[model samples]
Target chain A: MSQESQPEKTQTANFEERLQNSADQIETTLRSLLTDAPRGTEQLRPPKLLAAMQHGVLNGGKRIRPFLIVEVARMLGYDQAGVLRAASALECVHCYSLIHDDLPAMDDDDLRRGKPTVHVAFDEATAILAGDSLLTLAFDILADEATHQKAEVRAALVLGLAQNAGIGGMAGGQSLDIEAEGRDRTEAEIRQMQAMKTGALLRYACEAGAILAEASAKEQAAVTRFGTIIGLAFQLADDLLDVTATSAQLGKTAGKDLQSHKATLVSLNGVDATRETLNSLILEAEETLAPFANKADVLIATARFIANRQH
Target chain B: MSQESQPEKTQTANFEERLQNSADQIETTLRSLLTDAPRGTEQLRPPKLLAAMQHGVLNGGKRIRPFLIVEVARMLGYDQAGVLRAASALECVHCYSLIHDDLPAMDDDDLRRGKPTVHVAFDEATAILAGDSLLTLAFDILADEATHQKAEVRAALVLGLAQNAGIGGMAGGQSLDIEAEGRDRTEAEIRQMQAMKTGALLRYACEAGAILAEASAKEQAAVTRFGTIIGLAFQLADDLLDVTATSAQLGKTAGKDLQSHKATLVSLNGVDATRETLNSLILEAEETLAPFANKADVLIATARFIANRQH
Candidate 1:
């Protein structure tokens, strides 16, 4: 991002403005990355899957994961075009998850980011292929053309991403969410569920940033801590929104969690308690950044924005 | 495979024999790799996702992809755990694709390799997440572990796999298949479909073997040729089987392609034409090996087996 948006406060911005500014740049680059993607993806070369993927990945979302990568990279003072590549890779994975999550066999949703879901826009088969392709393409982008000369950092980035996205991370969380459907669970269980499903990817994002920056282990841990807390708060906010926010505003079929008989933070802890949890988590995330030597404002404010964003 | 049980001179020595031999060996050491899976992957892991993943991967199917990886590695005389690691990673991707393909939104398959489909065995959401996680985990297997010495090699492997599996490769093929659904398509379109979906991965598998073996670019191209032809033959056989085989014997739905009004090689070209094309392709594949100056009898036999296989 341009210096004007650099979060002058340096200690409290969570780099939201800075991150968004940088992320906007990354998104633009990502668009350039996609101008010829249909021809570029040798394995998934079908026009339908290409358009579906472009729809899923190119359609504007918050670009939060990519921003996190760039943010942490900046904190380490090591971001470059390489960081943008990693950010795009993370975006690809995140977009794939969204596409798959919206499938009829899964959440069965029909809309995403205020647009028709991939399955709704295309066919379910195409959506599944699109999601599958995006997921595969994400790693390709990260490993092939994404990384820089530092092999260790690249490996660390790939490892962090893989671990979070796999059974140990996003997959595990999603599994837990499915397991808890229609069943009441403890706050701890709910927390675990959210951590894996949502927190894991977010954590991966922060770690990718740290990795790109070649941050010290301690720094990586701090960012991880921040990611964990913020990810949970984000989930809690999402749950709360399901109850309080309308479909027109949220642009999603809210209250679907309840209709699915799923026990979210709102159902388990109630709106007020969930809000309290979100507040506490947000603070914890901010505090976690204290140990890091770099400017911690972007991550901090990112956490706050996640917790309180009106959506 | 003790070399004896591998495909040999006997006509009774079928692809199943070779596949089974490889499957047994890989399964024997499969658990060893899980030790390296993400540390927190199993904690609060989704039972539904796990079930779906296990259903697709652990279910009794011939580990063709893994076998090919090992076989190619063996051909290069690089007989360490690199081949196995690559095999495990390859299996993870194949399993992920199977899980997604069986979803109600995709192929909606109820059975695979003579077992319940992931969606049938578990819920669709679990299946989707399971597939997603498996895919993410494939990279984790490569990135988390310190198998490949050169990060470039690891990156290449990851890229190769992703390109083959992503929107342009297998997913691309699947997209074409979906688009062609209920419509007649030209032979070129059919070839493009098969090349993307099946050809991309097989070629990647071939290239992966060369890469892991540290084979030269020229050697890599040769294996790629073999893979391309074998992949086409494999798809042709699948098309033929859909028309000629019994569901009971095939271990899954039979003639479903024709029933669904989907076009296939057998549908586009007559059975005789497909047979001739299959022969020519296999011959081309075998000829690709000639430049290598090594006797790839097993690989050649492997190509021929692709043509004669029933299911």
Candidate 2:
């Protein structure tokens, strides 16, 4: 290998190590939280529901959203059990979205993370309930004292989460995506939808860190900007992978964008332009964190990783 | 009119008038909340999503849940904007469940409250998204400072809402209901499912009232018990309606329980037994509220309403 390639390879390896560590911590937290089944006379949450929830969440994924939450919170000096719990809560919402999106009525996906989807492994009704439970659990975690000592902070987290994951955010974006199918959409329209569907939660992950730290509004805005750029880059990377990566690499179907007529940046701008856009977005994301200097090195690394991930 | 029935007629009329007033207030609050469009550059929640949410919520249901929240809180000398907001939040969850349950994969009903179900009015995807949005919006409402002056109260409300509406509560019960279809379930099992599916939210509604009032633990427990008995009576009445009422009167399909092979209480026991059970439950509910005496007359009326609604 060339000498220049060695540094890049080492950076990639370091980023991967950091990500893996975050994923491991997140997994442990989530497993404990989701599996704390009802004890004694508490029989509201049945065993079947718990099993379905585990099937959806415990299925191996990078847990990237929670990683973002954890890293940002740590950078803001907000490393409490509350922060970790909040991160896990965010992951639960992400997992829930995936489970629902893969439903037959939505994406009709049979596989996710290289395994049978929740609706496939469990039944459709069970899958739906699991997703609903996970979504509700996210708020439950945020609203609890375990998530934050400050009621205001917990309230803020809950509000931010609901806004991001609700109509104007993820679900609305999804609705738009379904409507956009088989129809030509302007680049601006596609971008709007993408921001809502994907960017909102990513943006929330960073904003949550700020809320956890009780950071100034300016700092919150800056981190939000950072999250937004990376969020777009993440989508671009995903679109690029759709054309270039195999289903085995993705752990889900590849080339689905073209087949479903889904509007994506790559479909609108072509692979070359999309790659160029991703590169610029990553640079912007890096610049957004320049105020934090070296403290944001890991975050910058995360941006690059998001922009360049193979899966 | 017989002389004996004159006073009972007056009482029923009084209850209807009070319920109508509560329903009006809830409808106004929901409309304003749902239609408050984003200001400036914020465009996450789309108009279509908002419209769908309103369709599901603004329909002409009695808003019985919110009414319960209001009456109970008032009985406890806790009448504030927070009470109303919390009530609206609860109603949102109830409406979301109805929309989702009516989906083709579930009950597959086309009509709700004499109008096309959400999926029929819009599309399957929109209905799903709308329900998802409503569920999230409920937490959003509870977490806002406007919902409660105290952060702990807000946090507690969020926690309570999540616990009641989540896996161990509404969703878990829903899962059981679907799984129980075409399967024989003992009376105990059916009652358990009903408590989780329907009772949890109603239970939450009353508990919310007590929590908002900062009522004592014993008072809260008693109100919760009152809510539980009424919730069970509500379900039994629904089962009775399924067997007795016409589709036109109900505004949705009747005889669905038997058609779906659902293990409802009325199905497990005979209609006469179910009616007798409902009467005893109503008596129990009224007794549970006896501590408040005449202050809880409206709540007692609510229990009677649950027992006697023809549709």
Candidate 3:
């Protein structure tokens, strides 16, 4: 038992290292992307708006979505500059959502990642513009020729990102979740909302890697399915953490779901069942990537990390 | 004088009819695009968010941006379904900006187009999501195959729209304007702000048309210049109307610039000089389209209408 535990510990440490490296790389890429220098047809980047955008995005999170994108593309034998740019673009969308979500009218959280949120750090108006700019910047990055040699690829990435982040995906999910607050939502309704809110972006992260790698239709389907399963796992783990962890552990307010009467899976199914479902989701994600075999080691580890993450 | 005035009245009537027709077409296109049906990987469209989006976008405006896109494309000898789609996409961006700008933390306006603003109509959270969803939907529409057959065209449209609407363009302009409020701003500063805030999207509206028509670089430049001039004229006219028109005439609170201590050309140069500048801008716009000859008649009329508009 001791010997078996040693290898597992080593594997976990290795995966954490990989995750840290990916996070560092994404941070650098985002820094360059958010620089003061205007690109293409942009007239000039407003200094205050730029600063607010940097604040909202440069906070050190796990960058799990970017890690998934990088590792999935690497597993598919596509490691290129475009992959990093695409990952950064997705991170921009995620960061923008956080900024808007933290506004006074939304979650109204003053702290994010253990620091003042965008609206608190800057004025609410600046926060809104920063979020707007980051979202626009995402599409700009995806559509740029530097992101991909093929225009079709760039267009495809833009379309996919927009679809995932738009009304029917993340935003739609946010609407559903907002409406579900202070009400007892059915389990299925909660799942649907979760799938759209957090799950949609995570799914896009994996699918975008396939699109960038020019993976075959079958391989794309497999990776997409893998993404969908892990997305569920990620949300379930989040809901569980919200219920079981403290604000200090989460780096933001926790247990607010109960305070706000927000309907979450854990609220509906209890923590133990949610945990069980999360484990099953990780297993399914692993099975979905089985066809990729040894090449998918990092992606498989990522799924486990998502399912078991404390924050 | 009477005979000359009769021809002038006939021309004005014809131009107004054309403008109304374009507005009607754009309205239909927007209605179809904003339907409840989900498209392209969207799991579902939340009803509340959809309603807020429709409310924000379907408000009766002149649809000036869409009209410019349609008219410019027509001038370039290209009119198709793609033109209308692209026009609608630009309108979405326009409407989204208005929604966000009117937020309580921003302009805090209750009335838009003689109706309650999105935030007032629904809720602040819904307004933010609706604005976000509309922005995202714009990129989605531009990237779709129906917007343009060639992926290159689609990609260009996406890139252009993102640049014009993102950090260095409309959003950036908003930041500048916000910062300049309650402060003394130079004429140049005001122009730069207005150019970014209002000019960028208007420029894109015309540039997109040239792109769709695959017009020569020279023609594209000319049309783009026309758009720039008219964009300035649009803002100047708006400022003029703000000072001169009553609230009922404008369909919104008039003299808002003065009330908010916002800087504008009308404030700096006085109404008479600002009117002179507006006329010069309209003349410059007409001259820019001179190379297009008879094909540019509608566009020239549109420019004149923009400069002379009361609301």
Give the interface RMSD values of the models in order: 2.5, 2.8, 0.5
Q: What does the lDDT come to for candidate 1?
A: 0.76
Off by over 4 Å in 2: A1-5, A39-42, B1-5, B39-42
The DockQ values of the predictions, listed in order, are: 0.62, 0.59, 0.90
> In candidate 1 chain B, where is summed lDDT lowest over 10 consecutive residues?
B33-42
Q: What is the lDDT of residue A290 in candidate 1?
A: 77
Model 1: what TM-score for its first chain? 0.89
Q: Model 3 — TM-score against the truth?
A: 0.98
Clashes of each: 16, 4, 0
For residue A179, model 3's alpha carbon misses the true position, in angstroms, by 0.7
Name the TM-score of candidate 1: 0.90
Q: How well does candidate 2 match the true structure in TM-score terms?
A: 0.95
Off by over 4 Å in 1: A1-19, A37-44, A254-262, A270-276, A292-294, B1-18, B31-43, B292-294
**Ranking by DockQ, best first?**
3, 1, 2
Error of 2 at A145 (Å): 1.0
Task: Give the alpha carbon lDDT tens digit for every residue of A1-311 in model 2.
Answer: 55476998888887898899888888888898887575221356787778889999987689888888888888887788778899999999999999889998888999998889998998877887788889999998998888889999998899889988888688888888887788889999989988988998998898899999998888898999998987898888988999999999999899999888877789888999988888899889878999998989999999988988988
In candidate 2 chain B, where is summed lDDT lowest over 10 consecutive residues? B36-45
> Chain A only: TM-score of every candidate?
0.89, 0.96, 0.97
- lDDT at residue B264 of model 1 (Cα atoms): 81
Task: Give candidate 3 regions above 4 Å deviation.
Answer: A1-5, B1-5
Error of 3 at B171 (Å): 0.7
